[model samples]
Target chain A: MTAVASGGRVGDGSVAMLRQMIRIRRFEERCVELYSRGDIRGFLHLAIGEEACAVGVTEALDTDDAVVATYREHGHALARGLSMGAVMAELEGKVEGCSRGRGGSMHLFDAPTRFYGGNAIVAGGLPLAVGLALADRMNGRERVTACFFGDGAVAEGEFHECLNLASLWHLPVLFCCENNLYAMGTALRLTESETDLSLKAASYRIPSWEVDGMDVRAVREAAARAVEAIRSGGGPHFLEMRTYRFRAHSMYDPDRYRQKDEIESWKQHDPIPTLSEALLAEGVLTAADLVSMEEAVDAEVDDAVSFAESGTIEPVEDLERFVTTPAPADADGGRRS
Target chain B: MTTVTFRDALREALREALRSDDRVFLMGEDVGRYGGCYAVSLGLLEEFGPERIRDTPLSESAFVGAGIGAALGGMRPIVEIMTVNFSLLALDQIVNNAASLLYMSGGQFNVPLVIRMTTGAGRQLGAQHSHSLEGWYAHIPGLRILTPATHADARGMLRPALADPDPVLIFEHGSLYNVRGELDDHAGPVDLDHAAVRRPGRDVTLIAYGGTLRVALEAADRLSGAGVEAEVVDLRTLRPLDTATLLDSVARTHRAVVVDEGWRSGSISAEISARITEEAFYDLDAPVGRVCSAEVPMPYARHLEEAALPRAEDVIAAVGRLGGCGGSDG
Candidate 1:
């Protein structure tokens, strides 16, 4: 008999996974609120509908594994165990922020988790991930680098170049493509002449799998397989997790680009409620238990907000503190020895 | 002790790095079976195998970004850009990502990656292939720029660069590849933070690097014959520049002349000259002068290319204008 019957593995991990996904959902809702209030500057690209893909894939990774992400990464950073307070503070550009006010909303970074970056450039993180995997191979490390990009990145030249190098050298990398069916205003079909993204990957002989990102269990299963292959020295594996974002590409997007009915349609298959209902059907949780979980996550998010708000602004004199290390001389020359 | 060409010295550096540390590896276009664009990586694949000696597709951004990633992932990657001219393709990675990662991550990551590329004008490769952008890279922080002028530096700098905690760009003058020099099996460690005096004299200081170093030395010899003693300083490290050596030489000679192969406007020469004026303005008796290439695309014609670049004649004239006394050796 399966432990949870939610088509997932047994025991405490099941609960922990639920909590992780809840953390992302609740965290993003708070980010949206904060952005509207003018607390978090710059554009916010919340991964509301896509939380499962970020949490599930990152959960399968070891702390040593490097993570390279794109603009829409509040979920990934939270899933990687970056403090929710620091993430919020970074979004608020406070002194307690992970990047210390250097990289705002779109660029969340944590060193201890080995989170390499929150690079906003499209398809820019691909090569960095490939290189990181190459480093692991050369150093004889069994670690895998988890690179997360969107369907939009598959069209970039770095995508092709990275795939060729990763497969050619058999470097350990997990190529996680979150295909949400849209690249900013343009749909995937509009941007790519060839709509089969995995075909782009297969051209380099990389084995790939597709999963329903709206289903947590499905994402977990697909991610587990890809992660297992990479950790077990199976070379690089690709996954095209079909996902959708509940929000605009960014805060500035009028979203006249996408239809509201399509947005409402994705909400019907939303990962959070969809998974919760699945858990309820399996008798893993009740309406009351789910309500309690939601309350707990909401409280945690509130505490993070208060912490971020109470945090002080980094002194203007100390603004360029970590800009270089031993940190002397920043690009703007704010760093003083 | 064995005598090797400048390119062989570079290959030797790669071989030594690969054998000594598992973290070190080579990646670039045609670096594997082709044995490097300039044959500097010749005979490496046979020894280290294809795993260590990798060949990349013609994607500078992806491969260069991957090199930065590999460094963050804990490998000491040496990414060759085929030529510095082609480095523009991956300029985003070098300037934006690699140069900013350590500080941007709040000191969480240090790239420790070495990017090697052929630079300077020599071969009549025309407008695109004959430009030097080392000065552009040197302008950034979180990066150390090394211009390997001598065969020794070409062989020696890679070890220290691989050992440094930050990313380093090793600019090997394309023309210096064939220049041969004898070296002992064990070469001593050279500091990457200071400039070194290549030829000592008294009346004036001749400062240059990369392919221009030879021209500076030749100009010094010409000055000596013309009764003007010139001190030649080779700036091996461009960023966190060797201002100490440059200033001390100027203090002794009371005159300075910089020879740079980059364009005249907003070039490495401009930065060096500005720094000298800022730090050693009182020590100089006369205004510091510079001989830089014409501010235009490098023409492919042999005579035209020579006229467009810094030469001994140009440097000799610049030094003479800087008020170098006849053979006044200090």
Candidate 2:
């Protein structure tokens, strides 16, 4: 894992990481166009600048380990192995979607890969992640539950509660805080009395660190270290990814809260270009290699769009389904009706 | 049959659940070293140890959400909130996550979690510790709401609830903990559906559940001496309000009075009365009646607390308001 770290020799692993960031960026770029055409509806939260946080943390997790992510989690879902087609189909509210169109943009779920959800509510997934780790611990299974949330969730009571519980119970949880400055319109400094996010985790007596989120290699390295410590029975770990969202909080948000210069400054550190340039400078990635990667990502994104376009919506008659598990036949005879 | 208190019945049920399934463990505040807030889990800590009989911090949202997550991770978890009042802290997790998970996840994730909490106003516990909000929880889908009034149900409901693929909320009335009744020694898992006809009659139907079941039964006994043979119906499941049994009993009696510990407005009693009117309009000899608690936060004073709650006298008065049994011919 260290071999793929920044300043280390770039290899196939590093290139794959670069490719993942491009895939996420291209996918969400396509989503913006689809959203304009009204192909995707409801609140669309893009993780345009937070791809490193998603890909870095996710790549460090095992297939069997669980992941609980926020609404801005298209990158996490894609990196966790949910097909682009399935995610795109979900955004379009199609039956072929990952959640069968029940959970659109904010609630993507895939069971096989152990992806828990695309939770819409801030700080909502923290408790779920704690419980997942508790289950793994009680069952004697060595599995880490990586929970991703934004800076907004740090102010939530669930965040503090979950941190204490996870640490107290010695549960295997990797708390990935994507601290992309503003929690919606309110900046972190305004909401939090103490702006240092890692210090909050440290107060819970849990090991915490801050990483440059724009550097995918740094995120992956930090996440790997945290996941390793948790799996080795060292309890929960927290990594505050210092990043920024280049886009608005949602499609509905005008994003007037932050200045243009600030946005442009963050864009200068965009993860995709940062890693690509670093690899190019190190003679690890050629111009031809970068072009091929972009071409492949575009093709994949194009195919996903087509898949979403061809997908069908679920029937209205089945609307009442999944409200509750179907009651067993022998249990309540002639009672429910 | 052996005589037992409702508290012991609940403990036995918890013990049975813990013994039956390795995945099932009880997690709550004071459930371990401190026993339980109501002593419902008295000696189980020594029997099961800290791993199984886990005591958690006073973090309702975190533990409850963890229970849901554990359920998703293929473990059946029983999370006990000290009281329904305290459960408000975890309302978001319960409503948004536990109840919405199955439907929101496209049936891919089912939270097989059982959340047990004590409800009802009594013992002068004041405003925070009192109040019945099971009706509020009943409005949500993807979750099962159970209110066990009888010793048998208190001893039986947990098994099936743990077996349920979806989330189940068991609202145990705080006042009914000491109520003694004969529970069968072999009482196992009871069905999580339908209401039980505790007492049968033809004149009028007295509907109730949880803490109000005893009140309705007492009212029925008094009505018998007055030549008004009131039938007593115990609504076991609150969510999927056994409409069939409720409508069946209402159709037979023709006159009905709903007794609820919750308030009258937007109450479970209101829902029952409306359902009877909607489904069995012609069967009714008169309009449905209701007996409910006074609309005020439970006061610490015993007199005010008792007055605020529905008693047998209130049930009798409500039944009287429904008019005499003229048998639809009237």
Candidate 3:
């Protein structure tokens, strides 16, 4: 239940982390091109700059632990080990997608990985996370439900209600607040009177922490600590990851609200190069290693693109499928004998 | 067979579900210690314990969404909202999450949750506490809407609703809680996919469900005395409507009249009337008639509130307008 200590020396773990972040970044960059070329459409929200928060928090979770993420969840899905091809196929709205193409970029779902959804509504997933944890607790399972949302969710009433319920019922839930400065076009200061998200969480009597979201190591440490506390029956824990988005809120967003300098400043601390260069400086990762990693990521993205391109569109006739599970023939008007 | 109130029958159903399945639990505002706002869960807390019979805070969205999550997490949660009007606060959760999850997730996740709420305008609870919005909920695709119009349905609907592998919403008419009827001791889960013929007649079919079933039956009684035989059809399940039974009854009777507690425009009665016209248009002896609640928020005064709601007089008047009966509104 203790937090993992970081020795500040680059190792295989750091290399893997860097590769993961690179995979997310490169995959989304390819999506942007596909989206412009009309291969993929709909509201695509990229987590280009906030990759560290997704990678670190997901790294600390066990496979059995559930994850409820937001619309900006490409990084979260990739980090949670969903196959890149499935996510890509989903973005392309193909039958082979994670949600069978029913959910696009904002609604990715993979049950085997325990990823609840790519919920589009802000703060919508908090209550679900609380309930998932409640089910686990009631069943005597020590599993944690990690919920990821933006700072915008902090203003919603469900956020407060869920926090209070999770703490009051002693449910094991890890609340990850990815504060990427702005909720779409509106800045946090304009929307939230109290900008300290962790402080707001603490008001509900849950343990809270604020971490450097740009640093993968910091996010990992804080997440591990929080998950440990939750698994050890410390109730719910909140982490306010102070991060920024390097891209517009969505593909449709003009992003005219924020200054160009702000976006550039956040890009300077992009989690991919930050960790890679740290490893390079520490002599643990060579220039050759960096090139190979980039090549591997490129190949993976290319393969995913090909898979999505070849993915089939679902037939229009089956549109009504899954609206409700099919009932047994005899079960319709028959009594329970 | 034993005589029991609708409230007792519902409680027995809840008890049976909890006793049979470990995954079954009841949760909502004042569902535990407060014993439910209408006293339907009066003695449930001591019998089932606090964990299963949970009393949530006044957070409709949170608890309802939590119920959806719990259902996804492999538990059968029966969520109770005190009234229909209050459910608006959780509309996003119900529409966006609960109803859409199974389809949106490509059938990967199905919410097997049951949400129970008091609906219908009666008892002069005023506008906020009264409103028959089950029709609005029935408009949703992924949900199975059930209205327990009879004691057997009140006792029998929960088991099947829970057994369903999708979300189900049960609208319990507040006025029927104290209504007494004979329930078979062996009463068990009934089918949730059909309408029941409460009374058989040949002249016309009087369609109703939940609270309005009583109104329809009362109108039928008056019609019988006037020598105008009126059949009473209780639509148990509003969604996935028993179109077969509806058209069959209309086919035989050659006339139909829908009585709905919900307002006329875009109401379930409108949907039923349209379906009748669409499929059984040739079988009609006359244009289908409808008696619905007046288009106004319920008033506090007993007389105004009663006047705003559909009564036996409304149904009789509707039948008279259809030229199916010579009986005038009393």
> How well does candidate 3 reproduce the true complex, by DockQ?
0.60
Tell how far residue A232 is off in model 2, in angstroms.
0.9
Position B166, candidate 2: lDDT? 86
Worst 10-residue lDDT window, candidate 3 chain B: B321-330
Candidate structures ordered by DockQ, highest first? 2, 3, 1
Best-performing candidate as measured by DockQ? 2
In candidate 3, position A231 carries an lDDT of 92
Candidate 1 regions with alpha-carbon error over 4 angstroms: A1-15, A312-337, B1-3, B323-330
Tens-digit lDDT string for candidate 2 (A130-235): 9999999999999999999999999999999999999999999999999999989999999999999999999999999999999998999899999999999999
Tell me the spans in candidate 2 whose CA falls farther than 4 Å from its real position: A1-12, A327-337, B326-330
- lDDT of all predictions, in order shown? 0.84, 0.91, 0.91
Q: What is the Cα-based lDDT of residue A168 in candidate 2?
A: 97
For the second chain, the TM-scores of the candidates in order are 0.97, 0.97, 0.98
**In order, what fnat does every candidate score?**
0.68, 0.80, 0.72
Which residue pairs clash within candidate 2?
none
